[model samples]
Target chain A: MTVKELRETVKSLLTEGKVDLVIGWGKGTMPGTSTPVFIDTAEKADSLIFDSTCRNNLSVYFTKDRRALAKDDKKIGVLVKGCDSRSLVLNITEKQIDREKVTIIGVPCNGVVDMKKVVGKVDGKEILEFTDDSKKVTVKGREFELTFPLDEVISDSCLTCVRRDAVEYDLFIGEAREPGSDENAYAEVEEFEKLDSEERWERMKQEYSACIRCYACRNVCPSCYCNVCFVDQNDPQWIGKSPEITDTMIFHIIRNLHVAGRCVECGACERACPMDIKLLLLNRKVAKEVRDRFGSITGTGLENKPAMADFKEDENQDFIMG
Target chain B: MIRIEKERIDEFIRALMETWSVYAPARDGKNTLFAPVEDPAGIDHGIFNTDKSPKEIFFPHSEVLFEFEGGEIKKVERDARPIAVWGLRGCDARSLRLLDKVFGSAWQKPDNDMFEDPYWKEKYDDSIIFGTACNEPRSTCFCNWFGAGPHDGAGMDVKVVDTGEAFILDPVSEKGKKYIGSLKGWAEATKKDVTKMKAAAKEADKAMGEVFGMDGIQEKMADLFLKPVWNDIGAKCVNCGACAFICSTCHCFDVQDEGKKGKKGKRIRIWDTCMFPIFTMEASGHNPRDMSKDRLRQRFMHKFSYFINNYDEHLCTGCGRCVIVCPVNLDIREVVREVMACEA
Candidate 1:
């Protein structure tokens, strides 16, 4: 949606006091990415715009502010994409947010390019305007023409998304678009899998070897909801925070295992990592395997039990038992 | 109980693998682990025990309860089925029964539904463990502490004792009865199969190590708060939670808020340990276990005392992974022995 269109909707919602706050995105203090903003008034509503860097899921606020709600009165208006709305459905299943309490304004996302990726390509150049129509993106007054491929560039989830249309929403801001054909969602994992078992172990060891345990990945995951993490429990420390490879190994493996069938694959943890780690590869591996085995994808058929929650008569773990 | 020749073991396992996820000790070079295998033939039968337990398949190291995101709360979704741990030992299998008592019952403190974890339900719901006799017991193996041995089928779905040509499948649970019926290749029990299996158990019994025989571990723990020994023992202990990570029974954890500003990101449950100095620290910056000594005392007391009070079972499974993994080599058995020796 256009900047003016987004602002008008926010203003309309605020004027009616239909919501306590209109959550949106704005430019960040960082060089490329934008930060999340909670627009409670009409004056600030004008700044709410949909941009390429406005990539992080804004739906997280519904969960963060849940404790602040008293007996009544909580109507949150969210602007979401097809992929983002699927999380809303999964969120409903998880009861992270009340479905009736949310008012969703669905945006038909073509795809959003990560500013970090563009910035990395341009060697720290500034982006002036990332025209959605122009596959040709202008940066630092230089025109770079390119076609958007669903696999290599757009949100990785669109590759495997069963809900290319809005899963749960009150209104559609635009007509929905079909997700591109099945992408090689597991190509990276496939590459890792093709190696000898020992090589895969070494690869995992190498990847997790750099973990400093700041928990940026865990803190940023949309599905990683817990009030008391095992890492923080002292009475029986489940896993240590030691920076050593073995502790780090258990941490990374257990982290992935815990979220095996639950991860929404929003790329939040991978994006939030300061260490430039590919945490998504691990999480996506679980998603890929779950999909391959169950022939069911998360966030689709929102009413269906999560992959791990309910089992079909024929549960496939042939890979596991073999 | 049923009997099948040792050479026919692979066929029996393969048949079990059709309906069950066979988790057994498998090796990929140096790292030996208990993993689910479709082809039970690949596992080296000589490997007696796994470095890791089958506990994670039943009671995960970490798991999410539910997520609160974007002013919305999404409950964690899980649907579970049955998994069969093929080579689980007597000690670890018994530990699961203990864990089931804690998580399966409806006494949740803070109200997290991970108590009904889908992964746990799927694998453990109708679990049919096929335990094998530990022919070569490790120095660390101490199933005897809990009134068990290499051939003890206390909690196994089925116990297999190698009778030269065939394995005598001694069914320990109702689940084991159905598992044996499905095996067509196994010969009906001959007295010969039963006798050899018994002979193997008798042979293993001769080598069983002395049990710790420690008592008053729970009785003395109430007075541990007054004890001055926490300092000396906790000094050697680093706050790394590795011991809990490798433990067969430690089940503590915390949740994380991960996501965008408006969206509640992933609410994740991850492995946590009490060994960290700030574990007992409140967010307001007041730490209950201000010094490491208080933290150290809490760990021992909880394992031996508080858990017993609540569940009528000691938390430790006596797996000894903690002893080998502890950087300082602080053995938990030593801790138990020392606590028993200390004056009340």
Candidate 2:
């Protein structure tokens, strides 16, 4: 949808007292980025924008530490792309948020740009200005100007995203397109699986060793809403606080398992990670397993129970019995 | 002053590495950070500012204070040689000095070594800091806000300026002077080179533009401690430690004990931040900074008010790492402006 329509819709929601707050994306201080903006008044609704740089999953506000945003009978209006919508649905199914209190305004996303990929494309030049026309992204630096196909710099998750439109929304701003082809959804995972076990372990170690234990990945994740995360539980701490390879690996593995059937594949964790760890590789692998084993796609339906949450008598038990 | 050709910069780094364990900005996977330089060719001098700050060179993310085995405590050993950092920006150089006040000496009692941190002292006390002039400061850079510029040589042994074809290294400290005197095959910096260096510094300072007036920020922060401005300023914060972790001057850390069973363990200190809710949680389940806004307020207050109250300087160096990495884009620059504009 056009940004004008999105703003008008949010304005009406606040003006009509339908929602107390509208959470959306605003222009970020940095080029090729957007920040989550909380709009509470009709006048503030104009700050909302939906573009490739709008990478944050605004649904994260509905859970855990941010639950106060929806407290006191306040109806919250949230802008959701496909992944964000799934996160909201997951939150609702997990009983973390009341669906009644949220007004989901779905924006049909083409995809979000990965700023790291863009920077890499420009050979690490400082991007001063960034503009995208959906088909192409143009970045200008002090000495160079470059334009590239949108697909080239789009987030890795977006390349494999089966759903690019919200499955559940109170008001969808754009026309809902059919789900994207899933033929190449697990292509990267399949390639990763082809590697020998030792090679995979080495790759995992190399990737996670770079982690500074900042917890940006965990903090940005909507699915990771535990009041006291396992990593923070000092009473019987599961892993060392240090970014030791073993501890970092265990943290990632446990977190991956924790969100196995619930992960929305939003790519927020990977994007938020300052270390630029390839977090989605393992997450998508677990997601693929969930999809294959239980025929479950997370957050696609309100009535569906998470694969890990639901138990069936006749479901596949080959792993347990074979 | 000493001069080294731009193409032979690696040889200079290699020379420094012979005596000191050199740390420089280098490519580590997708990010550039300060890493140990065994091969001088691996050092990347072209980066504007590293993705992660050079603070990790002195104060690592995690440091084992001591290891214990059946009541016998063993201190972690380090290389006898001191450290030498290459290509640190002015902001990071200043950050180290700011941290040194806390770690190098007891601020309240200048003569007392009782409050000094041994681990930080061991690494940083004798370290030679090579402050590089940031000729092309990024848009987010605001070192000028804190009475600093891209070329401010506040905490450097040697001030290194890239004058296109060669580096003009000016000795700023006694150690730097002696070190430069010892180095061989380095030419004396000519008048033209000094002029180029000065011109570059001028252009970079001009590029930094206007400095935010921080005249009464400390007082304003104290006055607005219990005000609603914090709620507005912290509305979009995700309560992540990204900003604190990436910051050059954020020095808070938490110590934890790890063991195999209860027989043996090592006490380790890891980086911590007030951005986390648990950072201020009490044993009795009472948290002074329970809300995200409260934790967020503490970060700003400590940076602007409490640190200034203690050390007569703001804790922030305005390196702008937080400005770039914030997922929600709660820009600290805008927050500072908002705080300044707010009425108590």
Candidate 3:
């Protein structure tokens, strides 16, 4: 199996002292989930697995625990999906992590399943097991078996992903699979943009109201690694602490703007949210706008400078009243 | 005891709404949540439990306490109409009683009137809890581990059990008996109907076996403050507050004043979690629980050891919402097992 091959590679890396810790995905507590596991010894490498349920972007650990690992003069290895590798590139460009002190083990993915959609399908039945094959996903419950099309249950970002292979990796497992859907990646945002100003504002308001201020979206994103978030600052409270409608709106709007040109569209924020808010749509919307204005795509390779960090001599400023 | 035919639920809810504003589990798209309903037809009663807890009906996520203008402060008026909460399970109903210990008695606390919170009292004191017995508990449910079961009636005014075709309303409190007795056109429950409810509840209890052994857990965790088990348990935690927010009994809050300069302000109480870095931050820029490991230690210690010292009851109701909604899949049941294995 491919998981065994991946485990053997990680074991050799740990045994050869190439890296001190290997961060990967492990069997989760639920049927259709995977948890991030940190393994420091070769013996624990077997606990790692890569599957459709391995949805977490392990690159978030680069912002955390990387400093301590570097202080000890040890390299750390991280597993990355096609989308997760983009955030790692962003982290490298932002200088949060030294590229020399880390190893990236990328894995080509065939679109992870959106757990909310699966759970919604099996509404009242107790799910006993779940298996994801290429074309079909079977969810076996206590008294029933349900098979759903794989494309229908995948995360929305995965549906239109053009990058199926890693942008940067020392070693990659499995061959790149075909893109699930050929639709335009920005089709949803374009449809949203066609709405009137009132409709757009109302849609944003409804999305923000469902927020519980849990900060899961902020904490889970690899790009959002600020020491003190804007919401937590009390010196001059920028946003209200309460989950009031206006406060929620301002928090989300500012958060999305902060990661405007930097977001990698990994859909980690959307996946991490317990409220099931469609947060990636906003990030994708901002990414589209940034590309339209700057003629650049974020985190494609190491040579490309970030759109926000660089400027052209004759930049177009027609929208800015120049 | 009164028997309500399954078909008469809408009529009963319509009658109940005449006196009290009724809140029940209703379908909101694919998710089920406790929402205010004018008509009972909107209620989704076939589900085992709602995705969100019923605690929000009384203790809202955010609420205004008072308004200040110039030099004067005015307290927010309490809702005059009473509330009837339907579809509360055993764990959720018991969570209310657990919350009452902290917010219930104000007259006899260390500080008399200043610390007394009237907001929780106004909504919770007059509210009636109609707890439904779980006939088919979900796989994530663990209410049985806390010395409660699918049909335990520790804190409910009225205990309801589904008999497949009818609902047997067993009044466990004086308020429940008075309300059910005064209602017209409901048939009295027979002995045969009572037996059916008991048999169904027993089957449910058996289905959800004990996931974690609760015996001696408090003592096992009492003095292991400096042990390495905490590090192992806290390592995988992403420090997201989804566990605390979805929890039925987590009641931490932060009071803040929102206003403009030379403008009116509103003082509101917002739901806060101990998992956040700023929760224990001192005014002098020093944080005692500075690391994620420290914050994770405090969460388990407070639930198992400190709360047992103060309240003599564990704070967790074992609804398992946290287990299900965790982004990184950190299971508290595993935390309990790890704590139980710790050596003194």
List lDDT for all candidates, in order: 0.65, 0.89, 0.82
Across all candidates, the chain A TM-score values are 0.85, 0.98, 0.94
Give one digit per residue, the lDDT tens place, for model 3 in A1-322.
2888889989999999999888999998788888899989988998999888988888787665334553457788988888888888888888777788889988868788888888778875777798886677899987889998988888988887887667888888766544343347789999999999999998887777778889899888888888888988987667887777888888888899999889888888998888888898888999988888887678878877778887887766677875
> For candidate 2, what is the interface RMSD?
1.1
Fnat per predicted structure, each in turn: 0.02, 0.84, 0.65
Task: Give lDDT tens digits, candidate 1, residues A51-121.
Answer: 55556665554443232321147677778876677667766777677777778887766555554566555
Residue-wise lDDT of candidate 2 within A1-322, one digit each (tens)?
7899999999999989999888899988889989888899999988888899999998888777677666658888899999999999998898888888889988989899999999989888789999997789999999899999999999999988879899899999979877876667999999999999999999999999989888889888999999888987876567788888988999999999999999989999999998899999999999999888888899999999889999888888889999
Name the top TM-score candidate. Answer: 2
Tell me the docking grade of candidate 2.
Answer: medium
Model 2: what TM-score for its first chain? 0.98
Better TM-score candidate (1, 3): 3
- Give the winner by lDDT: 1 or 3: 3
TM-score of 3: 0.95
State which candidate has the highest lDDT: 2
Per-residue lDDT over B1-344 for candidate 2, one digit per residue giving the tens place of the 0 to 100 score: 99999898988888888889999889888788999998988887888789999888888898889998986889888788999999999999989998998888626474554478889989998899998989999899999999989988888999999999998999998989999998889899999999999999999988895898989899999999999888788888889899999999999999988886556988989899998877988888888988888988999998999999988999998899999998888899999999999988
